[model samples]
Target chain A: MSDLRLEEINSIHFDVLKEIANIGAGNATTALSKLLDAKVDMHVPNIEFMEFKDLAEAIGGAENVVVGILLTLDTGIDGMMMFILESDSAEKIVNSLMGRTCGSLDEFSEMDLSALQEIGNIIAGSYLSAISTFTNMTITSSVPYLSIDMAGAILSVPAIEFGKISDKALMIESEFGDKDTIINGYFILIPTLEAFELIFSSLGLM
Target chain B: MGTVIKVGMADLNVCKAPDALTTLGLGSCVGICLWDSVAKIAGMAHVMLPDSTQIRNNDNIAKFADTGIKETLDRVLKLGAQKSRLVAKIAGGAQMFAFGSNNDMLRVGDRNVAASKEMLKKLGIRLVAEDTGLNFGRTIVFYPENGNLVITAVGKPSKTI
Candidate 1:
């Protein structure tokens, strides 16, 4: 690894990051499809080097209410993984899981919240596992922490973590949607700079 | 008829009366608002970290509570506002997620709030009103014309202070 920095990440680095996102999100989408028993489609992953100001806008608007599932990567990569869904999409997924309809995010019961966390746990687990297998690294994540709030606010958690080291964050983002309901969810992965170095060395990219 | 000036994360700006300052999605970030009622000048800083001295990447002064507040105060004073007449109102700094880990980053909201207050005190800026330290995110708009800080959040009632 040639001293990789957020500002110095080139197209080749982006292409490799995109591939990681593709494989990770692909596996995650499969798990989601199985859990929902519905067809789920994923868009091509995007590698974004974004300022903190633009991070919130990536999910529509800063004030837009969202359901965020956060997990800390500990073992092989010291970083964070987040699963974000629009309020309506979250509600839809929860309702489907419970075989019933829920009104809004504000009215989500304890059971509903638990169900959402489980969904995040499974999807994030699959995503990390895919990356670990591809990179041949041991990656483990903490239990999912669920938060229902503004997208900007929820996104700040990752932004602050990244801001400590760099002005901009290199994010691997993927969008997954359920065909029947057209519900969309976003999965974002942010690895520390050191983690990136490890990944590149493991893959012989450096 | 005043335009709304946006303050992005880790950024700060100053505006005069009729012009309001606003910042969106303050999660674990503090929005420090300084106002000069006599001159109708207002400034807002969206600070992400508690202290700049603790971080190696400290080029952006506005990214830290200590430096961000001082810089904002300087800007407002330069805009024909008297330092003695400046008052402050702050918002944001909410714990957006509940985590069991004892990581300092997770408690950054509280630290940001504390650091902001400390800076304001050092500058002799009276913190008249504050809406902070909760488990939610806030979007704030500050009107220097009336020294009002309007706060809004998801599933929560909007309030003005």
Candidate 2:
């Protein structure tokens, strides 16, 4: 695996991974739309192999303050899934759900925080569930931990784990909700090296 | 303008005074900076894990607090910084995520901070100041010119130590 270059990944393998992500995110969109009673749509997921050093760039910026929901994979694949949302977008979500328009989250109540967590849980749960069904494998996920901080900081959890060996990590990026201005965010999935191989072999792409 | 050196995650670097070094967005990972006021030399390390011994095949010395801090001190000494005059100012090692359980992973920030302090003690280094163990992230810039470490975070006022 050390000799494997991301640039040389088979196009067919990339396509399979993208399709799986799309299907999973598609289910998440439906789940979110139902929860909010608002129309939710997703753009085509852009999947690529990214270097650990560039992880912050992949999100927005190193110092960019954002809301993140990270879930650790427990079974089938040892990996991580993160939901990244801009501050205003997250505030927009909280307001829309609570039926109150908020200009800021500095005074956000406990319920407000939990609402965001629940939203993260629902979306990630549905996405992982879809992937599990498609692959016919068990993919257990830990509780979603929500945080609001610099994009680099939020992403460091996985970056640290992968940086020890591989310089690159496979990144799947998808956007959901408003495409114009507010109410937009990204969903990212990173599988461990062994799991990466497992995914390819499971899909017969290897 | 001083040459600003950027230290990537789980990495380490050294620089002389009149120059600067930085590490961005530390969360559950500590950015350890050692500086010699007289020599005007500084070394910065972005450490991810507390100990390298727990993990097999640990090839990156800069990823662990024990080795990273030790190596940074050694490198700084080689660059004309006297060990006796060295002092430490650290930042980061934030919990980042708030969870209700006592799970060890969630307490990584606390553990990292403790490990860093322990390593500093073993190396006979004095920790003059620190900004750590919160539910927020930090970006730190170290200036060896005056042994000042500037810490910046979103929606928070920047501070210098």
Candidate 3:
């Protein structure tokens, strides 16, 4: 077996990712429109690719880190989009939406569990599908995993603690909806050097 | 007199006497607090999203909206709050995201608000007062004794809900 040559590998540019994001976002918008029976609006305020260290700084003060699944659906789109949110933010989002007094996670009951997972699955799944089409890549996603405080663990990695995957970070802040119901989705997309190359090459801009 | 309960996000703290129920940082999220002044019983929940189907759990409670509300209500009832006398006060659910962009995902916050309202309706609890929607975050405090609610918002004025 011959070793894969770096020369033969393809990589994606930041611009390519941005374009893909635009397309993926459009797909997500269309999906939302059909679901809510209302016009869906969205925004991608900032997008950039950086190292892992930079990604950590962006997370700033996240008490508990939630790393959702790295999932792939048969919906046809490729590429991967992972959903990571601070545990506090996740709880807050659920609590506020239900119109109940905000309490700790210990207060949640059986019904709440089903609701959160359903929403998480839909948003994360749809978002990734859009990214795949925009990038024109066939990337595989794993079943989304819920990593409780994984960020802390990741940061604690011996190499990361000293700084290893410092430059594999990408961040995007997206907002949607009207005056009555506004939602913001903050996404941090990080890719390894290998993955990065594959993405750019797949888009033919590498 | 009734007991008042106050709940915080990710944590639960309740009192069975005349007290206050409060929740903060509600954006597209809901603050549901039930109070029975005569019984001096109160229960509060600060939910950030609408449901919890996405969250897989092995018995850890207070993480989802539907279960969060039900649990809080049940706790209050256990504290001697009669369902008929329970009055609901709500605040939060501001549209934190702006419109007119290219990326369009489901607005989790909005769906949350709608879900909360439906749940309340199903519970047969009359919402005495509510402060929801718009594009901002809110901090709500409820005094069960007199049915007083003080809602303070960031970058906005504090008003009673």
**Candidate number with greatest DockQ:** 1
Q: Give the per-residue lDDT digits (tens) of candidate 2, residues B1-161.
A: 69999998878999997899998898888999999999899999998888889765467889899999999999999999999999998898887776657555677777788999999999999999999988888999999998889999888999998
Model 2 alpha-carbon drift over 4 Å, by segment: A1-12, A100-102, A178-183, A204-206, B100-102
lDDT of 3 by residue, A1-206 (tens): 12333233334455666676666656656665565566768776457554433443455521233433223232333223455455565565566556565765545565664445555556665656665665565555544433233332222221111121231345565665666556555454544444555556566655
**Comparing to the true complex, what docking class would candidate 3 get?**
incorrect
Q: What lDDT score is found at residue A184 in candidate 3?
A: 50
Q: List the residue pairs that clash in candidate 2.
A: none
What TM-score do all the candidates reach, one by one?
0.95, 0.87, 0.45
- The alpha-carbon lDDT assigned to residue B152 of candidate 2 equals 92
- For each model, chain A TM-score? 0.92, 0.89, 0.63
List ranges where model 3 is wrong by over 4 Å. Answer: A1-206, B1-6, B10-13, B54-60, B99-106
Model 3, residue A12: C-alpha shift (Å): 24
Candidate order (lDDT):
1, 2, 3
Best by TM-score: 1
Kindly provide the TM-score of model 2 when superposed on the true structure, using C-alpha atoms.
Answer: 0.87
